[model samples]
Target: MMPSIKFLRIIVVLSASLLFGCSDKSVDQAEFPPDKTAAVEVNGSDYSIEKGGYRWVRKKGLETETVTTDHASPNQMAEHLQPISVKSGQKVKVKIEDNPILNVFLWNQSGKEKEIKLEDDQITVPADKGTYIYEVLAEWKNGEISYTFVAEVQ
Candidate 1:
């Protein structure tokens, strides 16, 4: 068997080499893009923060539980709703029966989803030329209802 001092020295040298050798591989920050990045946009005197890649701007005072509604169900709420067609850069109005409190989310053809805030029962259509599908969720004391509609932009 080796002497105690020699054994200690061998252990120290091996530990030092392993620790120092592993740290030499430092990652380059430039090679990896940030998972979230913010862009500042200035229009006139107002500035807005635009986020890239799955980040969305939050709209206050609108929240609802998302529940899937079957289109075949006799209680289908969408059957009572109407589809909308709009020109590019035009705004579309969406009115719900009884105007129940609900949350509206729009999923674009590009697969990007956004929650829209209704002002006077209207939502502005996307400026990009594409058809967008919208989902509206409403919950009441008794039960819940989900309505869907399509907005076409030519």
Candidate 2:
């Protein structure tokens, strides 16, 4: 029996479609090469680090899915702050490991918790041009991530 013209076209189209069927992979799905970074002194002698150096260091893994509901965290991403020192009233940059830039916050240390925005990675807080311990609440997927670091108000 002879197939109709439409049926023949359909079969041809299907055959071509199969030829173009996706491979078992995609560019994005392909395993990315491991990342590496250079070590450098940050904020002078106060601290030193390598970009994206410390992360995913656990025998187990985390399963938190619902992302960044607030700006807090359970632990420190690093033992030292990115820029441990900064001048008070002067703009300083900072970033919490595995967190967003906007997630970083500044508290006045005045009993009342005031959240201030950051520039680049640091926030400017007006101090008496001396030394101070600023409680910075960095943003995390779970809540307000806090870090106690010293900044000199110069």
Candidate 3:
């Protein structure tokens, strides 16, 4: 009877360890959504960015999930936020955490979008003086996020 009791104890310990080990590994592999701030720099000054719509893939334990959220367009998103004043044709630096792949666009008031070329993590603002909405689409291996900012060219 004593030998049987000892065997049962060992089995329970081994089972518990295996369960915890698998859980820990899953937690390590799980990728959480982005919680960091994205910003833009203009002439050595940094401005905060407003987060926009996103489609992300999240993993937890043994389950995988695709999470997507829709928000207003870049031009509409800019309406609620204050615009950052910048000189016309100034070089604005894109600052996103984790250095994700970035695709930038310029949005006119008419709801049209034009892709802006990003050179060395920086984009040149429009040459004309007006208010423009900018969208920064950032992507990682697991997810993608859209960030918006309004820029007023002086």
Candidate 4:
């Protein structure tokens, strides 16, 4: 397929920025090859490295699918807690509400649990093919409330 004109414009802009030193910030020359690729920092808790014109390490916990929800209390927002059916290499995003102090966890079938740090009030689904238990904890001034959302991947 032919490269889009917009993509070509981006390449030109990035190339010019690199050659002209448009910004005061200095990037490691050895790491970022000026010929075809460049290293850029993405602002977030997600850890990543840009190389070969692609990100080597993805920020998701699993290598495949990712899941996120908009509801801080999935139970209260029962509509958002519905089971999602996603194919391989797809992302599941649910729209709901949000909370200031919220803690989320994902429990896999293997009995291993992972703490999910919400980005834009969402979390990524695991790469496994089974039932996943999503636990959401919200803290208020008086006490804390918990919610759960389940997702099944095929």
Instruction: Candidate 4: list runs displaced more than 4 Å.
Output: 1-82, 87-98, 108-112
Q: Candidate 1: which stretches are off by over 4 Å?
A: 1-83, 108-112
TM-score leader? 3
- Count of steric clashes across candidates, in order: 0, 14, 0, 6
Candidate 4 lDDT over 1-154, as tens digits, reads: 9999999999999999787885644443433211121111122322211111111121223333222324233323333445545444344332323333666777544432778766665566667776566665554332343455565666
Candidate order, lDDT descending: 3, 1, 4, 2
Q: Mind sharing the TM-score for model 3?
A: 0.81
Residue 50, model 2: lDDT of 23
By TM-score, rank the candidates, best first: 3, 1, 4, 2
Which lDDT values do the candidates have, in the order given?
0.48, 0.43, 0.87, 0.46
Worst 10 residues of 2 by lDDT: 52-61
> TM-score: which is higher, 3 or 4?
3
For lDDT, candidate 2 versus 3, the one ahead is: 3
lDDT of 4: 0.46
lDDT per residue for candidate 3 within 34-152, as digits (tens), equals: 57579999989899999999888866657897889999988889889899999989999999888899999888777757899999999998889998899999998888889999888
lDDT of 4 at 119: 68
Give TM-scores for every candidate, taking all chains together and pairing residue i with residue i.
0.42, 0.37, 0.81, 0.38
Error of 4 at 5 (Å): 86
- Indicate the worst ten consecutive residues by lDDT in candidate 1: 46-55
